[model samples]
Target: MGIKSFQGKRTTTNTKESEPILVSDYMTRNLITFKEEQPIEEVIETLIKYKISGGPVVNEKNELIGIISEGDCMKQISESRYHNLPVDKNNTVKKAMITSVETIDGNMNIFDAANKFLESKRRRFPIVENGKLVGQISQKDVLKAAMKLKSNTWK
Candidate 1:
């Protein structure tokens, strides 16, 4: 119904692969997120407990700040040279999060969102509404949409 863009990628779709899918239709509304001040141990526990590869980092007002991923934790692990002790005993997401966070709006079309993910390097993006996190989208969302397209199930 509308158009969106990110990193110069258009979020509009019309053809088989050009159709824009609404965020509400494909986004994970029940997504998990963390705050920047949260300890790295929490990040590890959350990732493992939920089996999630990553999640958005936010501030006290729920404003999206950055993101933490398995790669980041791996970085910490490697930096520690495989020390048995916690590598980030006092570290927080603020110190370790990737500052250049990518985000999308709830009204954003799935096609555009998918393009951003592909063109960019992030597999997941925090859904932002007025800069506040509302949901999340992952590569799985794009694949799900593509599956429907293959069957011509998109309405």
Candidate 2:
């Protein structure tokens, strides 16, 4: 039998009484960023190495230029295979990256972030400060924060 990896399913938490937490409270600050000029192959490798679904892409000035995800990489691979063209040096991450991204501020409440996740299909969101990427918050992180808040109330 082939081994299959299971990403945990989301279950709505009873957060009615949970206190609001900021995005920075649980966001991952150690960012794994990519350069816009980097090759798609390199991007794919980096994603795999980091075991993350997506990450922010930055310009030479360390500014967030765009974001790339596993879905985008898959689409590029599918199209390339269909076209019978190899993913060469010309195929860069910028070509496949999503330029229009929805980012959240680090100071935003976890409840707000959770609402955003429920409304959108994104698994993660980049936390920005003055238009620069600082950290990333995932749905799982929000859930964890909610659970922690719920537990703390019992103390």
Candidate 3:
């Protein structure tokens, strides 16, 4: 007598290749930017109004110059009090902004960008191309991208 077999037949079908997930696809294009000459007071107001922690500073030609954040504003405040100076218009973004900015390429993979954020401990990273500021990607953006791709296999 022959042994009974109950195994199902396997099917082989090629699946379509999906596009690579890039940083530019999930980055915010419309950004609230700042200028070097702008007053710290105004920057604070803008930050409050926009509910943002920081923003990138640009030149007249829209070139990436620096980055200003609440921490920078707080430093300005502390120094002002120590020096007995009022937080006035004299305190500009340039005085408080960090000139050594670290930027990422727009074409970078999202997973790589996530690794960068973890390594740098940065909330966000500005994307630069052609020596100009184009967009920004944050931790939240990476999460969103991950959620959107939840159904797809991570490779």
Q: Provide the TM-score for each candidate, comma-separated.
A: 0.76, 0.83, 0.88
Relative to the true structure, candidate 2 reaches a TM of 0.83
Q: Tell me the spans in candidate 1 whose CA falls farther than 4 Å from its real position.
A: 1-20, 82-86, 152-155
Worst 10 residues of 3 by lDDT: 2-11
lDDT of 2 by residue, 1-155 (tens): 96465756768887776456899999998889988888899989988988889898888766788999999999889898899988666888889999998888888999999999999989989877876778899999999998898787855
* Location of the lowest summed lDDT over 10 successive residues in candidate 1: 1-10
lDDT of 2: 0.87
Model 3 misplacement above 4 A: 1-10, 151-155
lDDT of each: 0.81, 0.87, 0.92
Clashing residue pairs for model 2 = none
Q: Which candidate achieves the best lDDT against the true structure?
A: 3
Off by over 4 Å in 2: 1-19
